[model samples]
Target chain A: MPEPVEIGRLTFTEAEIRRFAGAFDPQGFHVDPEAARQSPFGGLVASGWHVVCAWMGAFVRAHPSAADSPVDHPSVIAPVGVGFGLQGLEWKAPVRAGDTLVFFTQVLEARASGSRPGWSVFHRRNSARREDGVEVMAFELRHMAPDPAPGRG
Target chain B: MPDFFYEDFVVGEVKAFGSHTITEEEIVTFAREFDPQPMHTDAAAGAKSVLGGLSASGWHSCAIMMRLICDGFLLRTAGMGSPGVTENSWLAPVRPGDVLTLRRTVLEARTSKSRPEMGLVTFKFELVKADKTVAVSQTCLIMIGRRNPGARLA
Candidate 1:
């Protein structure tokens, strides 16, 4: 098994939370501070989707190889691909404004795709924790990447 | 006082709602901030990718689905938020200009044993194209407050 990679951190600012939520979610606890204070959360909270998007941003930025390679010719170190799905996505704790989250990704398994030629499927566990070390979110992501070793497939 | 509560969700009920047309500008804007993958952000790069063309990030599609859900029924219900999604799948690429709609089904509804004030409803949500192609499907559990606590407890 490969070592887990620390994808880096993100600080969820109030403005960022509100802007992202306003454009996509618009839930009371996410978009409006006053309305959020009256909601069950009792204060503005970042949308779960926003947190996931932050993780993705961090992950992609951490691997600069993805940006260097063309789509048809993927980097061996960072074979870019699209996510097929996710499972067991859990928001264990609320992420409030100003909370800094540290993200990590661990590859669980990888196998050549049976359906798609020259493509490999990766199952990875992605997670985020607050600066205090409390786990806040977790999910298993499935994505397809170009196989580094083509003839083997 | 929400219009719908835990007691209102019946198992096996199905409903369809939403009509969102994705735009290339929005797709590029969203991708530049989040995914940033070539297939999602650059048209020329996307044409060279296995996806065939500029496609919205899968996360973008999920966000769109959330907006549809909020507008369709969640905003009117006594929603307590969701713990997590059991499963989610992107069955097809969500290209720009695609008219997406939502199809929701109540797979299960059960009162919480520990939290009597709320119930858990399992839902299967599908983001379908205008032509009936399902682009994304998700199964998740949501917590909804009961209209009256312990009113139906056996």
Candidate 2:
């Protein structure tokens, strides 16, 4: 099994949150820092979806565009799908602007597709929390990694 | 954006429309900007990975649904916004060459006593493929203009 990768810690700047919230969300807690401070979250909070995005990046170890990334590898490739089971997703604590959070990724499994011509699954659990050790939000994402021949030996 | 008064949107109503053509380009573009996972960004890597082949990002599907809403429903109506979505689920994978249509059913509509210009409207969103496959579905809550006589214009 490939060693589980620890994507390490990253911080959320209020500006990043504002940028995402403005065009996509535009909600008071997401886009307006001053207003977010007064909300129950007690400060500017990263959008729940933003947290998921960061976690996905961490789980993969390298960015998709990295030179060594499989995406850049020779075999024909592409993702079939990504499923987020919201049943267990939790927004435990609000992630605030400037708060550093580390991401932990555990590779649950890797298997060759039995049904289709090119199919496979890379199951990963992505978790993130604050530098102060507070769990904020997280979710498990399952990504489809399709390859030419069955290669999950 | 005319306020979509409570009286305007009736429950059990279904609105169908969209311009989302599931292009590998649009899919990759969205996944790169919003998701950027290995499977989403690289086609070759995805072939080697477990999901076997290329799949569309779930968020990409949802975002496209959002854009369709803006074009068909939201822009023509005054909308406040939804508190959030609950029980959101993506039932199937969407891929390139897929064409999707949004079918929205007005589940419920009610005047908010405290908010004079708006009423809450709940909808069920379904993304159907060209082959009549239901690829994704979810529930959404939106703030819309109300037509109630007692409702004030926002």
Candidate 3:
């Protein structure tokens, strides 16, 4: 197992949250301030999907491995990899607008696929916490990473 | 139409949701901002990669699915909120010019043990192409308000 990666912090504004929700989520508690205040959450909260997107943005910024090259194509940036699936995703807390969160990801397991010789499967967990350190969301993500080393095939 | 309450969902019934046409420009734009992988952002680069051609980010597919769900049902339903996804899979590549539709199936429905005012419904969603290819599949749990909050328990 490799070291855990701390993807940097992110903050969502009311305008940004509203824009994303208006286009994607559109729940009253996510898009309308007055309606949100009357809703159960009592405030404009970011969509769980929006929180995941922000975490992806943070992941892209922190990982230098985007520049890593495969043995065959030393000049090409390694592919971003393909997702296999996600499991056990839990939204533990609501994220209101103006909340700043720090995100982190860790590779839990990795092994070359026995059926597909040139591909490696990675199981990873991603999570986010508020600036005060309360966990807001967590999920497991699985992806197929192309083998960088040669000779297995 | 009135909003749906706890008893509205029927298990074993299939509900069809949305229709959206995929576009190359939107795919690239979304990728540049969120995913940014060569396979998703650059057409030529993607053709050269194992994915074979430009493809929409799986997250983008999820976003589209959310829009469909809201427009199809959630907007008018007595929707409380959701905990999160139980699982999701990208079954096939989503390419430009593919007209996508979503279908939902009610797998389970039950009143919440503690929160009697709301009920939990588990749904299986499949985002399908015009040719009937399933591009994405997911299982999600949602909380819906009960029409009669205390009637069943009482």
Interface RMSD of 3: 2.2
Candidate 2 runs further than 4 Å off: A1-81, A87-153, B1-3, B48-52, B148-154
Give the poorly placed runs of model 1, Cα more than 4 Å off: A66-72, A75-79, A115-118, A147-153
Q: What is candidate 1's CA lDDT for residue B143?
A: 90
Candidate numbers sorted by lDDT from highest down: 1, 3, 2
Top model by TM-score, which number? 1
Please, what is the whole-model Cα lDDT of each candidate in the order they appear? 0.87, 0.64, 0.83
Residue-level lDDT tens digits of model 1 in B14-60: 99988899999999999899987777788877777787888888899
Residue pairs with backbone atoms closer than 3 Å in model 3 (clashes): none
Candidate 2, residues B44-136, lDDT tens digits: the string is: 655654456566777777666665666666656655545555445777778788888888899987777776666878888888888878777
Query: On a 0 to 100 scale, what is the lDDT of residue B99 in model 2?
Result: 88
Top model by lDDT, which number? 1
TM-score of chain B of 1: 0.97
lDDT of 2: 0.64
Measured over all alpha carbons after superposition, the RMSD of each candidate to the real structure, in angstroms, is 2.7, 6.7, 2.9
Q: How does candidate 1 fare on TM-score?
A: 0.93
> How many steric overlaps are in each model, in order?
0, 33, 0
Off by over 4 Å in 3: A1-3, A65-78, A115-118, A147-153
Instruction: Report the poorest 10 consecutive residues by lDDT, candidate 1 chain B.
Output: B37-46
DockQ of each: 0.60, 0.21, 0.60
